[model samples]
Target: MTEVLETTSGSSPRTRMNKRILTLAATGIGAAGIAFVVAGAIVFGDFGIAPDFSARLAAPSWAHWFGTDQFGHDMFARTVHGLNVSLWVGLIAATLSAFIALGLSVFATTCGRWADMLVSFLVDATMGLPHLVLLILISFALGGGTHAVIVAVATTHWPRLTRVLRAEILQLRHADFIVVSRRLGKSWWYIGRHHFLPHLLPQLLVGLVLLFPHAILHEAGLTFIGFGLEPTKPAIGVLLADSMRYLTAGNWWLGLYPGLSLLLLVLCFDAIGNGLRLLQDPRQAHR
Candidate 1:
C-alpha cells in the first residue's frame, strides 16, 4: 500500500507538470500572434499581394477565418497588417512624446525664470487648442501619412507629459539627495542621470505605457478621417472607414471585425498600463 501511494503521488505531480506546460504553450501562441501582426505588414507586403479573390465576400469559416471585404481582400490579412501599423505608431509616438516631455521637464528644472515662463506660455497655448483639431491641422500641414501622424500625435500630447514630469521633478528637487548633489558642484547632466532620473523612472515608464493606447487610438482616428496611413496600407481605421460604405448592404463583417480588433488592442495596452501602475504601487501590491 505504501508503494502504491508513492506511485499515485508521482503521477499527480506529472499531471500538474503537463498542465503547466499546456498553459505556457497557449500563452506562447498568443504572443506569437501579436508578433505576427506587427511583422506581417513589412514581411508580406501587408499580405495584400496574397489576397484570395475567390475568398472575397465569404463569411467567416474554417477556410477564410475573418471573412472578406467587399473588394475580396481577406479581412484577416488586413487586420494583421493593421496591427503592424498600430504597434509602430504607438511605440514611436509614445517614445517621441516621452522624450519631449522629459526635455521640457528638465529644462523647467534647470533653466532660468525667463525660459520657464516662455515654455509655460507655449505649453498653455498648445493646451488651449482642441487636441484632435490640432492633430488634423498639423497632419494636413505636413502632408499626412506615417511620419506626420507620429509627429502630430506626439507633439499634441506632450504638454500634459511635460506638466506631470515637471511636477515630479519639482518634488524631487527639494529631497535631501538633490540638495547634497547640488552642494557637491555636480553638473545638471550628472545630477539628472545619477539622481533625478532614477526617481522619475517609475512614473515615466507608467506614462509611456499609458500613452501607447492614446497614440494608437489617435492614429486610428486620423486614418478614419482620411489623414493617417494611406488607404493602401490596410490599417484598422482605414478598414473600418471602407466598410462603412457597404454596411447598409448587409456586409457587417467588414466593419465589425476591425472595430472589435481595435477595441481589444486598445484595451490590451490600457490593461498593461494599469497592471504596471498597480505593481509599482507598494500599497496596492498586497491588496
Candidate 2:
C-alpha cells in the first residue's frame, strides 16, 4: 500500500478528503482490533489444559471457531491468550526501549563531547552484531521467559531510535533559543524540562509506535525456538510450533488460523504506526 502521501496525496480536494478518511478508517480499525484482542484475552483468560479427546484434531466449527489442537485445546482461545502475552511483552519492551533511546540521546547531546562519542560507540557496537543473534543470546542468558524476552528486545531494538533521537536532540540543543537559554544561566533541568521535552516527545512517540512490530515479532521468534516463553504458556510461537508436527497429517487449521491471526495483528500495529507518522507529517496531515 502507498505510504504517507509523500508526494501530492491526491489529485483533487475530493480525492484528498477521501484519502484522509481512508487513513482515519485504517487507523481506527487497527485500534479496534488491538482492543478486541485485549478483551478476548481478558474474557478467555488461560486456555484450559483439560483435554477433550473426543474433539481432538477437530476442524473449524461454530462451537470451536478456530478448531482444536492435537490436545483438543481450543485454538482460538489459545491464539488469543498467546497474542495477549505477546502484546504485553511487546508494549513493555517497546516502551522501555523508546525511553532508553530518549535517555541516551539526552546524555549524549547534553553531557559533553566525550559523552556523545561514548554513546556513538555503544550504538555502533550494538547495531554491528546480528539482530536475531543478539536477541537469542540475550534471551538465553536471561533464562528465557516473558521478562527475558522483554529485556532482550528492549536492549537490542534501541540503537536506530537512539541515533534518530540523538541527532534530533543535538540539533535542538544548538538552536538559537537553547543557546540563549544557556547564556541566560538557565539550569540544565529547566532547559530540559521546558525545551527538550516538547521537541523530543513526538519523535519519541513515533519511535515507540514503530518499535512494536519488531518487539512482537522477535518475541514470537524466540518463543517458537523454545527459548522465550515457557512450554506451558499459550503463546503464538508455541501454537505454531505444535502445529508443525500435525500439518503433514492434514490438520492444517491448527497452524493456519493462528499464523493468520499473528500476521493480522502485526499488520494492525504497522498500520497504526504508519498512520501516526503520516499524521505527524505536515503534508500528509492536511491531506
Candidate 3:
C-alpha cells in the first residue's frame, strides 16, 4: 500500500498576495488620476486644455479625450483637476481631524474629568447639528472658499474620531500590559507615549481611512451648493454643478463622467478601509 501524507500550507502568502493586488489597484488608479490632475494644474492650468465658451459642447474624440464643456473647457482636464481637489480635501481634512481627535482623546485619557466633559460637550453639540448644514454655515461664516472648506470639514470630522479614540484608550488602559507598566513606576506620559500610543495607532489609522471618504463627499457637496471652492476652479463639485446645465441638452458627459469618477473614488477608499478592518481581525479575514 502506498503511504499517504498530508501537507499543511500557511495562508500568509495568499493573504499577502491579495493585499498587494488590492493596494496596487487602489493606488494605481488613484495615483494616475492624481498625477493627471497635478500635471494639468502645473502645465496646462486648472481647467486643463479646454477651449473657450464659444466652442459649444463636444463629444469625446481623439482631439478631445473627454470632450469640452459649454465653455469649451476639456471635460477630461476638469475631471482630473477635480480629482486633485478631492484628494487634497480628503487627505488634509482626515489628517487634521485625526490630529485634533488624537489631542482631545489624549487629554481626556490623561486629564480625567474636566477634559472628558469639555470634549464630550463639544462633540455632542457638533453631532446634534446637521453635518452638511453645519458645514455650509461654517463655510459661509469663514468666507466660503477652498481653505474655509478644509477648515470646516476638519472641524466637523474630528469629534467622532475623538470619541472613538477615547473609547479605545479607556479599554486599553485596563489591559494587563498597561497595568504592568504602571506598576513599574512609569509615568502616565511615558506610558502613553511608549505603550498606549502604539496600541491606539491601528484603530486611529482605520478611522482616518474611513473618515477620508466622508470629507471628500462633504467638500463636494459644499462646492456643489456654491459654498465650496470657486466656480472658476476645477473642482469635482463645480464640474458636477456645471454639468446639470447641459444635461438636458444631451451633454450627459458633463455630469455623468465626473459623477462616476467621484463614485469610484469614494468606493475605492471605502473598499480599502473595509479590507483593512478585515485584515486587522483574523476571524473576519478567514470568513
Candidate 4:
C-alpha cells in the first residue's frame, strides 16, 4: 500500500507537467499560425486585387504559386488576404458578443427573478431559431455588407455565451463573499466590479476565444450564400464562390487552397481555446 501510494503520487505530478507542456505548445502553435496569416495579409493585400490578365487561368508554378484564377488574381494572395479579413470580422463580432453576454448575465443575475426568467426566455427563443437562417435574415435586412455580417454574427452568437455566463453569475450570486458584500451595504456595481468580474474573467476569455471560429465560419458561409462580405473583396467565401466556376474545368487549386486555409484557421483558433480551457482547469486528469 505504501509503495503504491508513493508511485501514484509521483506519477500524478509527471502527468500534470506533461499536460501543461502540451497545452502551452498547442497555444503557441495556434498563435504562430494566426500571426503568420496576419503578416501574409499585410504583404499580399495588393497582389490579391491586382489582376494580371496576361496570366489568367495559369496553373500553379514558380511565378504564380497556388495558381492564377480566371480573373488573373493569385490564389495564395487572395487566400491570405481573405483569411485576415475574416479574422478581423470574427474578432470584432466575437468581442461584441462577449460584451453582450457579460451585460445580459449581469442583468439576469442582479435583477429580480422575473428579469432572470425573461432573459432566459429570450435566450431560448433566439437559440431555438435556426442559427444560419437568423444570420441570413439579419444580414439581408441590413443590406448585406461587412458591417451587416459583423452585426448579424454579433447578435446571433451572444445567446450561447450569455447562457454560460448567466449560470456562472447565478452561482456567484449565492457565494458567501457576495452575500457578505451585500450585507455590508455594497452596491451591486461595487460587488460586481470587485468580486464577480474576477471570478468570471476566465470563462469570459475562453468563451470569446471559442467564439472566434464560429463567427468566422458563419461569415464565410454568409458570403458564400451571397449575403456577407462584398464579392469584390478578398474574402475566403468570395474566393470559394469564384472557385466553383473553375473547379469542374480541372482547376482544383482555386477551391482547394482557400477552403483548406479556412479549415486550418478555424482549427487553430479552436486549439487555442481548448488549450486555454485545459490549462485553466485544475482537474486536468478528468479532461
Best lDDT goes to which candidate?
Answer: 4
Candidate 1 residues lying further than 4 Å off, grouped into runs, are: 1-36, 39-48
Better of 3 and 4 by TM-score: 4
lDDT per residue for candidate 1 within 1-287, as digits (tens), equals 86687586655555655655654454455446556666666676735545566667788777667888866787877887887788888899999998888888888777767767877887899999998999999999999999999999998888887888888888888989888888989876677778878877888888998898789999999999999988888788899899889889888888999888887777666666666666676654433
> Which candidate ranks first by TM-score, i.e. highest?
4
Off by over 4 Å in 2: 1-10, 46-49
Instruction: Return whichever of 3 and 4 wins on lDDT.
Output: 4
- In model 4, what is the error at residue 245, expressed in angstroms? 1.1
In candidate 4, what are the lDDT values of residues 204-249, reduced to their tens digit?
9999999999999999999998999999999999999988988999
Q: Write the per-residue lDDT of candidate 3 for residues 88-193, one digit (tens) a residue.
A: 8889999999989988898888776887899899999999999989999999999999899999999999888899889988998899988998899987778778
Q: Where in model 3 is the C-alpha error above 4 Å?
A: 1-50
CA lDDT of each prediction against the hidden true structure: 0.80, 0.88, 0.82, 0.90
Give one clash count per candidate, in the order shown: 0, 0, 3, 0
* Deviation from native of the Cα of residue 46 in model 4, angstroms: 1.1
TM-score of each: 0.83, 0.92, 0.83, 0.93
Extract clashing residue pairs from model 2. none
TM-score of 2: 0.92
lDDT of 4 at 134: 97
CA shift of 117, model 1, Å: 2.4
